[model samples]
Target: MKHLLTIFKYALLLALSGVLMWYAVRGQDLSTIGHYIRSANYFWLGITMFLSVLGYFSRAYRWKMQLTASHQTVSYWNVYHAMMVGYLANIVLPRMGEVIRCSVLRRTSGVPVEVSLGTVITERVIDVLVLALLLGVVLMLEFNKFWAFIESLFVDKYDSLAANRDVLLSVAGIAVLLAFVFGYLLLRNLDKLRENALFVKVIAFVKGLLAGVFSIRKMENKSLFLFHTGFTWLVYYLMDYLAFMCFPETYSLDMKAGLAVLTFGAFGMAAPVSGGIGVFHVLVQSTLLVYGISKEAGIAYALVVHGAQTMLVVLMGGISFIVSAIHSGKPAAQKQMSVSR
Candidate 1:
């Protein structure tokens, strides 16, 4: 049943990605995209791929610090291996990468799978919050330019709501009244609620997660963690900004434009598609379009950026997996041989 569910989820995400890819390319001239890609500056692209590797290393180190804070002493190389394997898994399996990451760490370092997963979950939450904060900054900087674009998204929804305002109001009134009644009842029966087996189990699980989420507060080297986090984002922006210089058509775009693209592209990557394949293209192209770039140019840019990053992950991840297997397999084999003797 679990395997079937996983397969179904992947199929759904793959279908959604295909639809988005079609929407992005439906009207574009493929020849022009190819031309732009062929003419791209390999110099900048080389640098972009270099930065991509550094980003992975930085992230691995940051994760190590998080694990250390929880008293799980793992080697730097193991963490790096786990991180690479996770990226490789993501290219093939979308969000299953996090589970793969925890599994790798557990096998390599003897850390409990649940504890490793807790740290990973904490890292993901932190990353999302940081991305949100960065998005807010970008919006503030470009709010005036995007006001109409943003307003258009909501104007239709506002009109629909206004048309049915009376009915919505009645629903809201009933929801608030029911909330009050439930809240009162829950408070009155707090002791009974605590005694419920399912509730008790859920509470215990939540507390463990909360402890992991708050682990940063107890870290000995909080400053180092902060530095790594900030540095990772900085490298991320540089990765995006450098890709702009890869083609003459996009070279004219400034840092602010890169920031906007980075913000939206991050959202695309965060989507449930495998490695942000189609959604990243659409969101990056859309952001470029807002800056008056031609659709062909945007597609070319997206192809180079996403392709190079993906290649880097695949290359490093392949090497890491092989090396980890050799390093991990030898000891277990020796132990088994000794036991047989």
Candidate 2:
């Protein structure tokens, strides 16, 4: 049931992105788009694909570091499948990859599903903190532009963010209080129920997963994790820049422009915007306009870049899925990993 809803979610994102692209290109005819594509450097597309795959490898390697505490190391190929399959799920939902990919791993690699989820939550915290720090630094350098860009999103006459601060604060306080109450009740209920052996196993699995997240406790070699983080984001930035180059209109934008677009795209992915659907196009075009690009051209560049990257993610994810299926069929290997599990 959750999986079906997740599929619906991704489908919605695909639809929204399609509409945004249509609206973006509505001004110019297909011939202009065709010319743009024809003139694009296909070699860069190839390079972009290579870097994206590298990003997957980095994720796999980093996750292995996170899992080292169990004294178990799965092959990079296994991790790649997990990462890719997870990504495929996320493209449809805002963050449903945790469930989709972890579900697959639990079945094939004997990783506990609950633990898989806990590790994902841990991963999200790390990712969000890194993103916040990077965004803060970037925005600090371009505060006027960034703030003004934000203001542009609001209707000029009716909005009063500052004036409503008190009300917002009161509302937020109430929500937090309610959350605490509900969480306490939920935990008490779980404590009351101890009838099922399966449930106890699930609880232990979750503990193991949290342990995986904490496995980085041994800082004897932080270099590997740092290297993987650097490599992963390097690919992300390069992919953003290369996508920008696909359109002549954006090629002249400075490095700041690329970074800004990448940051905005990351934010868009966090929204319940249907796999980042319409939100991604809107964010990219808005960021490009801040850098002196025309609205039409900015829209075009955003659409092209968004389309290409989406294609790249899906293509690679499909390959990973196929590879994992073949890997799962080997009974001997399955038994081998079963012991580790």
Candidate 3:
């Protein structure tokens, strides 16, 4: 029933977005939009594509580094493949990449999938810190008069879209906090929490998870982490901002707004919605509209931006899969990655 409801909700959302796209596009000449899309700066699209794909690989490298493996020297080849698989998975589900990527690495390297996955959490911790830091900077700098509407988008109670967003974010925060609390208490009182075999198993599972996350116990690999993390975020913006030229109206938006769009894009894509389909489009479109672009142009901007990004990840990841298979004889099932130390 729950799964059915989720499917139904997504169906509704997709339907809604389709309607909005139509209305926004009501009187607009799609031929003009097509011409705009065709006349788009292909060079920038190419650049965006390259950077986006490169960034995911960079993310893979960081994940490999976090493992602190004795056999793997953060093989770009392996990381690239796992990242691709993960990205492809996310195109279907919400945040499923962490586990799927872990599974891929575990199969290829004989690593404990759980442990590998834990390290992914560490990677995400770093990512979250960096993103939050960036968001803070962007908010502080752009928080003047220009930010009023966007801020109200968070504040306004009468606005359905605005209200839904804030509520969703709040709900997510609550759920995360609840999970953390449950885990902490369960761990602290394992004996009591283990009133049955299932309870004990759950406790054990959480312990294993905690262990995996802390897998890089004594490894001091800050340089690699900095390189990968910095590069991942840089590419994120490069992918988001540079793709602006793909549309007609946003052709002249400043670099700062591009960064702002990236910021907004992060939040938009953070939803649990499928592939972030409706979520991503709405956020990107709204952000552009916030900057005075028409809704029609905003939708166009969203499509071009996301489509370009998808193409980049899919193509690079597809290539990565082929290379890893043909070049690396490794079965992707080994538990211990051979570090090049």
Sorting all predicted structures by TM-score, with the top scorer first, yields: 1, 2, 3
Candidate 1, 205-284: lDDT as tens digits: 67655655677877899888888888888888988998999889889989998898888899999888999989999989
> Which residue pairs clash in candidate 2?
10-92
TM-score, candidate 3, is 0.75
Q: For residues 189-246, what per-residue lDDT tens digits would candidate 3 score against the true structure?
A: 8776668888777667677667667756645777767877788888888777778776
Q: lDDT ranking from best to worst? A: 1, 2, 3
Per-residue lDDT of 49 in model 2: 75
Best by lDDT: 1
Q: Quick one: how many clashes does candidate 1 have? A: 0
Q: Put down candidate 2 lDDT per residue, 255-283, tens digits, no spaces.
A: 77778888888887676655676777778
Quote the lDDT for 242 in model 1: 89
Query: What is each predicted model's overall lDDT from 0 to 1?
Result: 0.85, 0.73, 0.70
Q: How close is candidate 1 to the true structure, as a TM-score?
A: 0.84
